[model samples]
Target chain A: MARGSTRPTSRDVAQAAGVSQAAVSLVLGDKWRGRVSQATAERVREAARDLGYRPNLAARNLRLGRTRTVLLVVPALTTEFFAGVYTGAARIAAEHGFGVVLYPSPEGIGPARDPFASAQSALDGVIASSMAADALTAIRGEALPLVMLDSDPDGSLGAATVNLDIADGIRQAAEHLLSLGHRRFLHLAADVPSWTFEVRARELAARLDEVPGTTVRTARSPISIEGAVTAAQAALAAPGDRPTAVICDDDQLAAGTYKAARRLGLRIPDDLSVTGVDDLALATAMDPELTTVHLNAELFGERGMRALLAVLEGRAPESGDIPVRLVLRGSTARAG
Target chain B: MARGSTRPTSRDVAQAAGVSQAAVSLVLGDKWRGRVSQATAERVREAARDLGYRPNLAARNLRLGRTRTVLLVVPALTTEFFAGVYTGAARIAAEHGFGVVLYPSPEGIGPARDPFASAQSALDGVIASSMAADALTAIRGEALPLVMLDSDPDGSLGAATVNLDIADGIRQAAEHLLSLGHRRFLHLAADVPSWTFEVRARELAARLDEVPGTTVRTARSPISIEGAVTAAQAALAAPGDRPTAVICDDDQLAAGTYKAARRLGLRIPDDLSVTGVDDLALATAMDPELTTVHLNAELFGERGMRALLAVLEGRAPESGDIPVRLVLRGSTARAG
Candidate 1:
């Protein structure tokens, strides 16, 4: 029992407590209520604590055919939105005696590495974001249970899907802008070809199509403030009737649009109106607080983990998309 | 092998290749240079691929007393800084046939959970951020190779430390502001009681003390835009002569300072000047791009992982701090 020599085993605890190995197993496993006396169980527990005994979980999990660990695959962790997602997912995972490992697939760097090889843990299940589709081929090679978040339900190869109601959120944004007397519009789309971004484009177009004299021009940019600024500035300065409203793919894009507006001497809500999705901290930090769709990232992550857990347990995952809301702020007003 | 029946074992691969189990082991373990013929090794590899056989890394690693995996413990994943760190660490780890699992210790949520219990992997070592001090007690209980990132080298209990040259960065910032002829200053400090933030405060105070006719005040705020707005506004509105310059602990606080200045009808660089640390993307997004310190977060992470690897190999870690730079942007100017 010398410090740092080796981890004490259950047998060491039993020897220290003067109890049989079987009694130690039963008590430590929490299944000794009927067989072992209360006093003996307490003594065994005390011995284990005194010896700093820790069960070899890796060996035990291998024998049990479960690792009690899942992999949460994300596109990248560069923004607080995904961080919120991981936080919510990890909280739920801890409650269920499961640990969540993150695998952020390399973005446009190269072919995706096998997550199982990279995670180095025998995973019971996987929860993946659709934005990380580059890693799907490698993941599909394995026969583990999986749940897709922010994915197209009809295209996930029969995997359960947990998605925020992004289409509905887009509809709400469009309705709010249309009600504010906006007609000319510029859609600052994320250049990534993910199903979630596709939904944003599709829903916005559909909602705008319902109104007459509504014209929407599309500009694609990488999901970054710098990239958005370049794309937005070019589109806004094009030789034509300038769009009075800009609907950004996300808050970062909206922040860039604000910069673009500044360069063009267009004041927010006075000369132009802007709206964005995913009310990240940057949303409020803008000169005029962004009018954005507040998609609860933590709740999205919670539902994703819950769906993954259900899939692993041989049960049907909950159906229906999580709802989102439009938050009106200074960034939007009657079109000038 | 039938699809989804069971994972094909090395034995199945040997049988399919018509070779002895020992030959398969030598070939797959990459120890067959002299023992097995090249043709036979190629045949065995093809059989493994054809049968979809994967080595049981968990069981093999258990027997070898190594998991080829490490844990990265951070305070939170809510910022791009830590995300950059993880990316760098993971890149190095992958190159060495190792995997990294992140454990963002619960922030202010209660007692810390043992990362070993939650990661559920037999980790070979750990790379921890000092901001996550709450988890240090749990980590210290286990005997493992440890590396500290952004920690006080003198106070890490003998753990190897990797840090940015925060003190030098602060000196440069202070010199820049002082050269602009600022005589009064306000330090907008992060409320977190971590060694890195402490370094900023100490270095800034030490630098400003050398100059005559200079006075400074301090205000504390949580490292968020909203919290900074409240803190900066009150500090700026104090009854005494208002400080002509503000130096924030980080970029988020600087963004909040911009808002506070706007609320008080003060123009940046004209009515007041500002400086910050951590030149995040938000720095350039601000109307007047922030003058701040640029800490290479990815390099810090890479160095941390390299140090942990060196410790695991019983070698001395690389010494010296990673360098940082002061980026001059539009946020600062000569006091008006």
Candidate 2:
């Protein structure tokens, strides 16, 4: 069939068969007991087969008491990172006959006491990104089956957890920086205390600490370009030895650092080597581009959606972290 | 009162007053209806005021049997255009104690036949962006209130419409191009059959046709960078005469058109000028910021939500198109 060919409903089949649509629904839903006559059910089934009539989902969900809808709570909507995850999760959920509703909890922008109030459908389950912990204050202790993404994996709180292999990403980044013979590092961490960023910070510090003669300086910034510029400027302005390599928590931050480097008369990878997490479109859009972690947000979304469906179906969540890989770009190089 | 303020609940007030939560709900809800004694109602009211209690929205909505939730059905999550609309709509909705649920029917990224099924709550009304017309086809005939955004002003199917001043935006763009001594224009129109795009093509042609010796070469492209590139490339490759200005339907398409010009060794505003509708973040982020029409997606969204809310309240929708403005950035200049 071509695109937009047909989405024939059971009612269409019923009309063709000259029977009540309920008879087609019963036969298709496989609940045709004493209600639907055997001959009539067969005729309805045959007509439905010819018409490609799928049952009306709204009516089915209403009768089934569960809509197979999962609510995904996130911190913000600006970044494609979360959007990718949503797309990925939704893909998986669709395969299993589930729908995902994304709630970019208003708390990240300001104060949102309850994100669920916006996701009007009564949920069969929930998949929440750990970035929005403030919104979770209302979500905790609810009987809703929950799955946590990019959170403290060990701190399960009895909920299923999905995470990126951020440790590996950090390790790859640190190793690349260290291999470049960089003795000093500046870790521009996000000011937000998310487990994902925490992992980057801790792992970076630990890796550099292992190098006897290496030094690491820390600075905080909000996950934005301007914030990163300010934070990087201050971190670089110290009256001591300047760091040779700058590692940022996100591409947006890296973009800011790019401006900050330019302002400081620093050319990326020449005066300072910069690395970023989340290989966003902006990373590539940057003039010199950026070396960053390729977080498969869409795949992450697909996995999260799949995990929630599994939980709803009384199945265990798929184990292991969603692996993240570093994309080598022009932004990072040997310390000059 | 900063960041995480303690919000008082009516139940908390009731417990403090040694009264049932129902008494508190009734008194605060202003629906005692002989359920509570006048003296008890007074006690509940005083306790509520003393405790600074406010009724939770869920309970309030439940009591009213009307979920003050608006389902916003956008065609996509791919671009920031609809995202801004959602933000705008949501901001307006929040002021009235209403919540907005994104209805991702087209995303069919999930298996749910109806997008609202995943939102979990039944909506009192809906606001749909033009992109979701096919998805809206299934939902349009429903009893729920609906408001169409950026849809056909005339063919609103009896639903109230909140349209962008698209025709005016096109007219302004053409006039701006014309004023700059640009007689030849490439109408980089969206390939979709939607009414909004039709307006762009019609209005641009009509406005250009008004001026003697003015010419418009129409080129169709899907609303994507790649689609725009291919279409723009073909349009520019045409023999003999070439348009000095390209008017794109949206920002992403404009960005693609820029790439097409670069491939053909054309410089923006000098060799060829381009203007886009929907001043997305990409507008500024582009190399030469997009000279485009500022289609107020957020205002369109806000108005759509407001209209839907008004319809649900049995009130007339706000009449007339939401206005759009031309944002002249670096992408266009006086024809040399």
lDDT for position B272 in model 1? 91
Any runs in candidate 1 off by more than 4 Å, and if so which?
A: A20-22, A107-110, B108-110
lDDT of each: 0.90, 0.78
Give fnat, all candidates: 0.57, 0.24
lDDT: worst 10-residue window of model 1 chain A: A105-114
What is the i-RMS of every prediction?
A: 2.4, 6.9
**DockQ of candidate 1 against the true complex:** 0.60
lDDT for each residue of candidate 1 in A1-336, tens digit (9 for 90 to 100)? 338677787888999999988899999999998899999999999999998888877677667768889999998887889888887888899889898898888643236778888889899899999898778877878868999999999988999999999999999999999999999999999999899999999999988998999999999999999999999999999988999999999999999999988998889989999999999989988888999999898899899999998998899999999999999999999987
lDDT of 2 by residue, A1-336 (tens): 112443566678889888987777778778989988888888887887776554544445445656677888887766667777777777777667677777877732236646665654556788898888787866773457789898897886778888889999989988988888888888999999788888888888887788899888999998767678789988988878999999898887887787787778887888899899998766765556689988888878877877777787799989899888889888888887
Q: After superposition, how far is residue A227 of candidate 2 from its true place, in Å?
A: 4.3
